[model samples]
Target: MAGLKKKMTIPFARVPVAINEQKYVQEVLESGWLTTASKAAALEKKFARVVQAKYACAVNSGTAALHLGLEALGVKPGDRVFVPSMTFTASAEIIRYLQADPVFLDTEYGTNLITPGILEEAIALHPDVRFLIVVHYGGQAAPMVSDENQAGILEICNKYGIKVLEDAAHAFPARLGERMVGSLGDVTCFSFYANKPLTTGEGGMLTTRNKEIYDRVKKMRLHGIDHDVWDRFTENKPSWEYDVVEAGYKYNMPDVNAAIGLAQLEMAAEFRAERQRAAMFYYEHLGQLQEFMDLPVTRVPFSDHAWHLFPVVLKEKAPLGRNEFIKKMAMAGIGTSVHYKPLHRMTYYKNRYHLDAKSFPRAEKTWQGNVSLPIFPYMTPEELNYICKTIEKLLKY
Candidate 1:
């Protein structure tokens, strides 16, 4: 057995920063246009092209993108939105922000994403569902389009006048049968947070094919202004006049952040390849521990994974409990995280929605055993080997 490292620290994620990231940011700083200006606009254009979406709007965070997308989808107070309980709180919290209610759905066993069967069941139970937020869990694209039936999630939702919004926080560059996630639904939200596949310090983007939604999001993203703030200063005539079309939030991505995003977007393909390599490394090595742990699904039907996270689930037969295993890894200077704790299991959501563990059997069980290992694009081979060997050693203890 390889000896444990006396001291080392592998972070859960180290945000990817490209060589040009600093150059673009420096240009933005010297230009003195700090708000959502040229770089932000450039990022929006570049991201839309990359994701094959007709329109893209950059926002301050993934949560902002969801909130704005929901508002544009015509989600109203008291409306019922179907959301997966296994996602981060941001996915469902937006429903509450609009004074609407969330009908939490359980995840599919293998993919850990909300499947069509579960969606159908939720529809059967809550026929009044007007909106749905499908999160591509663990960077694996959820089956938005189905082969089982002609009517996929979008088609079914359209049939009943239910709008679909995709929370693609973990699924940037992920695809479903030639269609990228950003173009898969009515409006798809992508996170550019430090830990996501792409990072802009703190930013996100909303993509869509609907021109109306795009226009609304653009106007509403920055305090409902009729014209972009940049237009006032950047124009040859320098017009300062503008109108607030409606009450909106301050959710515009700054030039500095967007500069970083533009660089990140440019290097997305390379970053994805590296991350995928890391995922493959884990998959190949972790298979030997199947009796002790269950690894994430690397492949999904009709979809390509972005490999943003590598989550492992400890089985009942494991030598250590989930928490115990995490502690042991920490002692070896390795960091780990739980992708989620199932929103329904959280105190705020559970108490408010009258949810119990029994409400979502799969998600509850998955939560109990879930542990996310480091799988960033920059992770070294030595780091990967150390992680795997450490797990092997921990299992024996």
Candidate 2:
């Protein structure tokens, strides 16, 4: 302890500012059309093209995108939505918003995603379930393209008339062959939160191949307006009059946010590569600690990971518990986080649905020891080395 140097603090996550972010923001400021105008429409088109979707609707938040996706699928009260327990609250909360029930499923230990077996069981248990919110957990995709009799997960869902709504919040540029996550699902939602692969401070996009679903999401995203204000203002024959098609929420992304997203989109590929590099650094260094922890898996067949968050699971034989390990890391100026607590363990969901921790064995087991290390596009090589060394030292001690 006598010769120990002070350790500089490392943050768990950081947003990478695109080269043109400031320029785009400044342009939006000068244009004077801030609320879901030309910028939003342009972003939508570009984003849709990037994800290989027919349409994309920009919204205020990822939660809003999920909510509208449910609306687009016509989820009604008492309808049951099959969801994995190992996800963020938004994935389940949106089901409640529609007055629907969420039938939670267990996660697969290896992938930390819902598998075909889980799907089959859930379907048998709740035959009337109409929707499935498959989250691309940690940017590693769910079994969208599986080798099952019904084809893949998407096809399986189709067999049951269950609409597959992808919660692609962590997966922006993730792909399975030529088809992207957004294009595979009936509707897909993406987040542009500060810590996401792409950032707009706070924004999201809802994409779909169905024209009807696309049109409905577009209208519902903006107070059910028959047409967006951008159309009227930019047209040669401009008129202020508009009709409200239905009661809808006020969930439109402003131009300021869209401008940032546009700039971020331009550098999406670069951002993904940088994140992947950082993840590889973690994998290479941390694999040595396999006796104590399960390092994040990089190679999953038929898929390309977005490398959103590098999560490692501490084995049962670990010397210290997850929280204690985190405390030690914190003291050493190394930041760490848990990807999620199983949603069923949350008080509200447990009380509402009568869930027991014993039921979701895989989710609970994974949640107990999971830790997400600092991973971002901007992480320097020195930072990566420091984190790796710190973890190795802690494990040895």
Candidate 3:
């Protein structure tokens, strides 16, 4: 490998930025209100308008958003939700938080979605599935829960009073037919981590159409207080009088983060377009390799794809195993990772759910062979060259 040219690096993600993001964050810092977290409310409003979510509430993280979505949907203990086995741990962990059980359903062979057929089969076996938690893996829209596929999955859920909670950490502005991802389901959530399409450094938002759910989420987000806050030490506010109606968690976003998000939201279209451009470049250059790896969906062939992850599943006969390939890339200074390792593989869930990898074959396939490549909105051309060179070296033409 000595004569080989030194390869430039490709980062897995390059956070998008707007011209005004820095200025806005500085303004928030100068304002001196660092912690009360009102920017979360403003960001909520911005989120509602941007994604067309009827209501939006900010939280500390994506995991917190999932938990709040669960609580807002009234998912109580003993409830059983159907979740695809191929997803981030938060998708199932939130269910566990409520003392609820999550039944794992494998994803479709060619798609990241949990097809209605699998869901229908699983539902038929366990008539008690109280919640349908569909995960939209890698920023693509979740499979449409239309009545056509499972005959009456939603209708049956309605009859049984089951709820729908979508885990859309990767999906930002993901579209389902005519509606946005946040608008497609009963409750939707999005992350604004550094790697997400929108970045608030570390923040998330929970959204819904139900006003009642919004009301509860709003009050619960900042502790069950009925008033504004204790910081206003000015004249109009009372000296010391507050009402603690019920218990709540301190999962609100700070103004600094919201300022970043507020500015980032305005640049969403540009960010999305850049992401699309990068996806096109990768596809045009690498798509012929379908003989080597399963390429990402060109369009979902039905609706738009947000392209949050450029995940390529290795063919069984590929030159290297997924782990081996990742090792090679990392050593070459190209970062890579499996989107997930089957939540069943985690010690916590494995012990808690008594999950055996052998029981779910498809999930194991993902665990064994799926690898995500760096597809960022801002990957430099030189960096792209190195990423491509590294892959070309590892694969059989």
Candidate 4:
């Protein structure tokens, strides 16, 4: 052990900071108004403008945003909703929150996305399904509108009168064609968790063009209060006269988190560029290893993808299985994660719904090999080299 070299550590994610992060956060602390206030309100306005949506409501988490979005869409008990089995649990669990049943559908193989074709098939099977939650998987925006010759998800949903709620947890600042993901669907929810493209410590935003839906979410996000606490306190009339219009959850984003979000929002484009740079580096170095592993696929330009995660799929011909590959990467001081194990494979969904793994062929197959690599803003060239080289050394056998 005399001259053994120390291994270099590369984390699965590193939160990138903007110039104003601390400055804005300090101002919020000094103001003594930390709960949902002016800061949160300002964030909503700026976020709406950035995503090109008519209205935005900041909430405590992406899951809260999803719940509110679905509630605003009028999802009720006994309603059947279409959701992809490939995404995070929140996409499907929120349906259960409303006492609705989730009819999980399979995603496309390479992209791990619910395509228009998949939607059509699911709709035919469940003719009464009137709601859909489409996830923009791993920063790549799913096509919500039709392109030249192909019908998009929105078009297919429209044909069946299904309401679409976009779960854009990994897709802040992502686009389809010229439009941002938040503005593409009936309602879109974005996350600002510490590791998301934009970090707010813990927060989310719901965006929509519909005034009715916007108004409903706003009122319902905070115990169904007719007026916001900030509005009541700042206005001359009275601070404690607001009425609870209906039962709602306590899911308001604090001013402290909003302060961080405001700063992060200002630097979103720069953060996205750095993440894309890291993604491109992986593609350049790992392109040759496709015979053993499959790189992420996207229909849009690389710049249009937010690159929140750089996930690879190991093939049967790989030198090792997914778990062994991840273990080897960790041993080499590189952190990695499995994007998902698939909802159909989870005990709760599997047992409760009697889900068969065979039903979600694409998701099950993808899950078997899916491993999310280290991709983050400001990843150094040396660090990138180490990661890719480590992967090649492990898989080239």
TM-score of each: 0.96, 0.96, 0.91, 0.98
Query: What lDDT is reached at residue 33 by model 2?
Result: 87
Question: Whose lDDT is higher: candidate 3's or candidate 4's?
Answer: 4
Ranking, TM-score, top scorer first? 4, 2, 1, 3
**22-134 in candidate 1: lDDT tens per residue?**
89999999999898899998999989998899999999999999999999999999898999999899999999999999989999765788877788888889887888999
What lDDT would each prediction earn against the true structure? 0.87, 0.86, 0.76, 0.91
Q: Quick one: best lDDT, which candidate? A: 4
Assess the local accuracy of residue 310 in candidate 3 as a C-alpha lDDT between 0 and 100: 82
Clash count per candidate: 0, 0, 1, 0
TM-score between candidate 2 and the true structure: 0.96
Across residues 198-256, which tens digit of lDDT does each residue of candidate 3 receive? Answer: 88999898989999887777677778665546233433577586677868778788888
Clashing pairs in 3: 139-170
Q: Whole-model lDDT, candidate 3?
A: 0.76
Quote model 1's TM-score: 0.96
Query: Candidate 2 — what's its lDDT?
Result: 0.86
- Candidate 1 vs 4: which has more TM-score: 4
Range of the 10 consecutive residues with the lowest summed lDDT in candidate 4: 1-10
